[model samples]
Target: MFKDTNQEDYGSTRVEKDSIGEKKIAADSYYGINSIRARENFNISRENVHPELIRSIAVIKQAAAATNYELGLLEEGKKDAILEACSEIINSNVAEELKLDAFQGGAGTSTNMLVNEIAANRALEILGHKKGDYHIIHPNDDLNKGQSTNDVYPTALRIAVLKLLVPLTESVSKLQSALQAKEKEFSSIIKLGRTQLQDAVPITLGQEFSAYAEAVNRDRWRLYKITDRLKKINLGGTAVGTGLNTSHSYIFKIAKQLRNFSGLSLSHSENMIDITQNMDIFVEVSGLLKAAAVNLNKIASDLRLLASGPAGGIGEIRLPAVQAGSSIMPGKVNPVICEMINQLSIEVICCDQAITMAARDGQLELNAFGPLIASKILKSLEMMKNGIDKFVDKCIKGIEVNQDRCQQILDNSLAVITSLVPYIGYDQASILAREVRESDKTLRELIVEKNIFSKSELEEILKIENMTSPGRKK
Candidate 1:
């Protein structure tokens, strides 16, 4: 989306060449020869490369230009033009020029070249040259100098992953905060608690929500900590992380340039070959995301159980009615939000398996599955963040408790006898519980009539405040 201020006329088709042969692409296209070949070869995955990965590659190109210019390997004009082109990619939708398929094969070489080619043509335009004038500034020579797909793609992928994680963690934090708010609001409401779909004991709704909050908080921190290893990159490791064909000064200086350009606290990996050869870092990230998804699935299942029915089921809490749940079943409402979350969580867990298989199947020099890994991980993060945000805004924030339903269930259930166990022995409490479940008399009547506890004592013991934690003033 650039205006031809230089007023150069363009033709319909232009010829471009690589090691294999020459191919004709659109004269107006910003993508170059390798992109043409890649577009033809890897058309299976129609999905465009992740936008954040494109931005990250552009960032690495800027850093490379700066470092090359400092080392006197690149001309000042070329460096400035490349920087301008990369800035355009980063700060604008000019990154849409990177149109190669995300699921490209073999360690993302096509995707890397596509970024380099896009920057080259855009820079050529900035310098008043035609689109495909590689004589002045070439994609591989100038734009991709001192880097290889091995180092550059993984480094950019890491940068992209770190960038994408910000919103996801924020979403998790919001969910945790919302649950905690519910915890405080429902602190006084006593409800039935179940284990294996059977009544277990009495628990305040606040306590249930508090447990949910704690689980989410743990997942947030789990994602936060596993990303530390990702900050170490192998930028200078050219083809196989050995720093071959690159100077020692270049190897050491690229990290600082990358940090300055990307604004991330990055460092050089102590062993570049190891980082390049093994993609365990990505596997670790995916596993943590799976943990988060598992927690969310459990929480969603709980909400659905608590909000099961208005008259026929548990009916302890009421979910927000965000949509018409049925087309023909008049006045039917369902827990669609929680159901959607359940589906999303299952998808994320499956994606983790894909990422794991990608990591596990890599060979000695480099992992050829970077493209798949990047695409899946980035999509998972985005889905999770958006799902959590919607769940909070549409479901959690608007939920209401069926207080009367909860109280009725608490009064009729045998779970309340657990609180009386410490006062009367477990054997006697069990007998009273069985009798109440079978006979028409309530627990209060059965306990008082059996002379185990008087009416006043029964009333004091079964008070809502005394049912939970001990030592409260009546």
Candidate 2:
């Protein structure tokens, strides 16, 4: 008979078996054991455990245990043990070896396994027992008791998003500050404003900066609102949106426990069926991410164009130089950071689309594709957060306005004709602007030659601020 050999190490054990001839096979002893099988089974690489999401799992576990304690579902001793174990895992400074592969099936089962192994081993130490001994707080029996992959995974995603949302909001606030600073610095400067990429009117640099600041603030509010909706936890909804095998007391208890642990003001979701089947929340969050991405992309595009050339392009703004642009191009300082932010925005937009598709692909009770949703959303959050930080620090903070360029563009724009409407008549101003455009001369020069108004009088009337708020300007 083939015999299984149980070998004991110092505080650790390995299960081995002699199959066929003399070949010995050993069972995996770490949290990533299932990951090996999952990798082979699915052979899919698109769904991997992101590090942020992995860290978030620990947060979710803590939140769950905390909720349990707060609601008295778990005794003080048990809660302390669980929390101690979780804390050990989170605080441990392990290298890259502990990280799980990003792509795994079963809706982030690999990450769950990783956390289980780490927490289980740490708990073993806490209990003065050998590691890999599932007896005192077994990974599946005690640690994951009353929890299912369905609810736990999604709850973890929400927690992770919440963690990221804090910093993202802060970054948005920083961006606003930078824009406001620029607004004040450039208040007296004016430039030709564009509509559909063509010169339309004249506006102060301050007003343009204020518009950007408002857009970022709007995005911040959108993200904040989306996160509020996400705070509703599905922890009580065990497998298949049913509290099957879960104690009725444990249901409410866990939510309360998690709320205390996370300090997130979390509540039990009103509808488990909707929570389980509808991934629209992810879509909603993703849409916010997309909007933020679009905003950043627009801002980045504007920066790049504004800093385009001292000789050929607008050259109306200068961005900070973090790295040399090209190896061969002399004095070429590229807007690499802004370009990186733009690329990240594109990636986030793509992730949003992937989230949309995954949400729509859900068939009945479960989305079956939550792994993808989780990965994409988490990725987008991380990218956005990092990109915003870098963009703010490396680009926005050091941005300098070219006042001379601004004045030149403003003086050359035919849009000043609008300011002449009250004095020269709209028909005359229109005729003058057309003549100026045809002759390739400055609008001021054209107005002078046409005897539309004296130079000093035109200067006083055609101040950029006066064009938009006609009555407010003195």
Compare the candidates by lDDT and give the number of the best one. 1
Candidate 1 local lDDT, 1-474, one digit each (tens): 643221135458779987788877778788788877788788786688888999999999999999999999999999999999999999997665466687788789988988898899989999999989999999999999999999999999899999989899999999999999999999989888889999887889999999999999999998888778889999999999999879889987889999999999999998999988988898899999999999999999999999998788888999999888899998999999999999999999998999999989899798999898998998899899999999999899988899999989877788878878778789988888888878999888877778977887777887766666756333
Instruction: Please give the TM-score that candidate 2 achieves against the real structure.
Output: 0.86
- What are the lDDT figures for the candidates, one per model? 0.88, 0.74
Question: Considering every candidate listed, which one attains the maximal TM-score?
Answer: 1
lDDT of 2 by residue, 401-471 (tens): 89899878876667777777777688987788778778878888777786867899778887767775547
Candidate 2: segments with Cα more than 4 A from true spot:
1-13, 16-29, 39-48, 59-80, 93-97, 422-426, 439-460, 472-474
Candidate 1, after superposition: displacement of residue 38 in Å? 1.2
lDDT of 2 at 258: 69
In model 1, state the lDDT of residue 105.
87
Worst 10 residues of 1 by lDDT: 2-11
Report the C-alpha displacement of residue 70, candidate 2, in angstroms: 9.3
